[model samples]
Target: MTDLLWPGDARAGDLFTDASVVEAMVRVESAWLAAGGHPSELSTAFSVRDVAVAAEGGGNPVIPFLELLRSRNPEVAEHLHTGLTSQDVLDTALVLQLRDTAAFVARNLDRQVAALARLAERHRGTRMAARTLTQHAIPTTFGLKAANWLHGVLDARDALSAAADLPIQIGGAAGSLAAPTALAGSPAAALERVAATAGILGLPARPPWHTARAPFTRIGDAFVTCTDAWGKIANDVLLSSRPEVGELSEAPAEGRGGSSAMPNKHNPVLAVLIRRAALAAPPLGATMHAAAAGAIDERPDGSWHVEWATLRTLARRTAVAADQTAELLEGLRVDIERMAATLTAARPGIDAERRKMGDDGPYLGASDELIDAALARAQGKPC
Candidate 1:
């Protein structure tokens, strides 16, 4: 029966095709073929065997024919999978994809952090008015603000890298590897072999987590953290680019924005896109968590299935957003003169306070000390 309600096709360029995912599939397929498993069982377990093995075979082959295909072109389904369930391949594939996605995001985040660090250093002492609760509060440096953003991005990058190390599921039927145990040694040995295979593929080596889904949930949480940082940066850019503020501007580049009415407008469309991407993260995370939480015993009926789609979607969206965010940050523009003017306009009240203080030193109380402390911390120096 053809399923008309199936989601659109996933292209080869999708983030799901990350190297980790490819390596994982290769590992599973290798294990299956090494265990002398029949292609029929494998086809039953992985419904997309044709799609997975089409490069080595012609059309859709029957179970018995698949074995012949496997033998004739052993390389066709080389290391094909055996003794594992669908969840093993699917879950492991997810972890692999996440690992690659995390790496991609980390690279971009590092670039943004370094760029912001330079911007912060350049504007370190350039004073600007600080706002709190939507009202002007005190004087602060534009560089300090950029430094704060860099710190947040750096923290998120570390978190994402840590979360990528979560284990993948590899247990067989009933999450006990009973079938593989009957064929090979004990279930423990079977699981160890699976873990070793996963390690060979660069995935984290750990016991099957068919029922325990903290790993998957953690990946989603990490993505949320990254998106939140990106969204905050975007929000700042949008606010600073406003006509009234005019303290910052998007770089004058092609493909920035479009308008039907306004001829002299350079909207912060990239900032808006960043916000949209951040907004999309929570629902994806919620769906993943709900799927994990609904797991019943060793195998939650459709929980893992639900998780697969969301995980893939999350990876693709995150990669796109990360790439776009890096580009946006790299080309961001700041007007130091405008910033100074804005600050000077707001300094009359602060000057009044300073005048009231008589000769009690500088008006910036502890701010310089705090900045020094922060800078020291960032540079790995003790306060």
Candidate 2:
């Protein structure tokens, strides 16, 4: 399913792949072993595809995965899991994938922000008609609009970056790792040692967080916010690029946005896809919140399972939008002459003082300060 909707960075795509799921299984098992727990040849019985097929029946990949692992090598079966439950493995794997995804998000966002900043700076005085409710209301600059877009992107980027420090989930079925430590050793000490091994794999196992669910929720919100930023940019791009408006356009490229029915037509394909992603995002985010509400009693019935696809889709879609936005900005074509033509007669009631701020003046209240703050945010620096 992701293969069709997915057309973005390779690394980002890899995070959600079947191979990645298997790789995570290996990491989790190895981490358990590294902590002085003895495990077996894991793949003795069922193959990778067999585990996946088994997951269809159990609603979780871990149950079948463990069964296959132990069945293949019974002698080492007892030493394998070391008291972890299916939820523990699944949840921790999610955190691991998200952790890797954060780096990809950071890279793409940085590129996008930088491109927008440069575009905004160049068009600081480029004027256009500011619209309210889809009607021309006042004069504004293309630079200010770009800056506004930059500000939103910056906010989303910060949210995602902060959310990136996701805590790994490592609780057993009932939300405790006690089953493994109930025998002799100190639970805290053993858990800490195992967590250290997890840390080595780049997934920081910072305490247990299976019930919290904040990490997933926060990331979902960030994904929604990020896509929304692109949506605004895409919406404006669509409007401004229209033949009637002609203020901006998707930079002309060979075989890009070509209409199948009309050879003469060139569509704003990137913006279209970005807007589509934004439209899809809010609903997905809502689902995550709804799922959070249902995460009751120690484990959720279907709520937790709901997020398995929702969060992945949300994050993946946002990543694709980010990459497309960066590419769009790189080749974006601005028609300064056309933009200025729209300002022959400004709206009657705009304040004279506000209008004096230059072409970008009236619509950009404190935009200079805002853009600076946005730049600081993009760089992950103190403002």
Candidate 3:
């Protein structure tokens, strides 16, 4: 819940707040009523702390939450939460929040990709030493490096987008819409109403996901992939900006990347933060994956709770990492002189690789063409 490290997603945090969650549940209830299955109205003045205090004892907040709402307006109690279970409300609310969160993440990813494209086009022919297995092995261009970064980001973004189309949960108690079938005639009709509600909420409509946790699992995996892509960029920045090999540096900014004891220390703070997010994501993802197996009955013990926290944190960290990577690339400084100087030290290694291929010089095969192809593909144009 403490998003101090990954702070670009303030809205994402707000979406999961006690009041916002209560509101989302009400929204779900309202959508159900609007489908003509029931009639109800929810009060926005419901006390959030009351539900929070009740849920503190390790049960779903929806129970006490509905109690408070019905007490406030007893007339609408029958229609409100009439057929839905705790997980139904919680899962639907989660998907609603995730849909909005995905929009912000998508924007950041697009900007990051565009920034990398520009960097690649600007330095298409700026030669640099390409390292493999932590050793210089071949001659390449900064453009190629940027292009590779762009490709990784594009792939991760695509994966994340696909995962973001989350399926909504509407199966009533025990993973069957039986409780609600009295109102909608059959389970299929109730699912139709659920799909309609999801359409309004901007979510993918499917049968009950009570026991099926793949939606959250895929989301966690996609975010982990995004963090990995950004981490690759960060790792390269950290290595290239080292004092001994100062080929790349973060743009100098006042009061940024300052050291506590070292006077002349200007670190790659953005990259470091991104790397931290990348490092933090996989463990959270592991928790989600593990939680999936624990989703035993219609309502398991603690697996869903694990998913709520883990998925939100993963999305927040990934969003922050994407935002930081874009900002880093926007003002990223590339020292052509330093890059050229490193090439001299890397000549022997490069020559060894070149001799193995019987090549005489820098064989930057199709790097420029790659940059052009990436740009064209980004622009939705034929390459």
User: 270, model 2: CA deviation in Å?
Assistant: 0.3
Which candidate order results from sorting by lDDT in descending order?
3, 2, 1
Evaluated at residue 256, the lDDT of candidate 3 is 84
Candidate 3 per-residue C-alpha lDDT over 1-383 given as tens digits, one digit per residue, 9 for 90 to 100: 44554544453456455666678888877777766555556676667887889986647777888788778867777777877888898888877777766777788889988899899899999999888898887889999899889888888888887898887788888887887787788867777787887776666777787878888889888889888999999999999999999999999878888899998999889889888888999999999889989988777778888787676677667777777888898889999999998898876767786788887656887887988988786776877
User: Model 2 off-target regions past 4 Å?
Assistant: 5-12, 37-47, 71-76, 345-383
Clashes of each: 7, 2, 0
Q: Return the top candidate by TM-score.
A: 3
Would you estimate the TM-scores of all the predictions?
0.81, 0.88, 0.92
Taking the tens digit of each residue's C-alpha lDDT, what string does model 2 give over 227-274? 888899999999888998888899877778898799988899889988
After superposition on all C-alphas, the RMSD of every candidate to the true structure, in Å, is 6.2, 3.4, 2.3
For model 3 the local lDDT of residue 133 reads 95
C-alpha root-mean-square deviation, candidate 3: 2.3
| lDDT at residue 210 of model 2 (Cα atoms) | 59
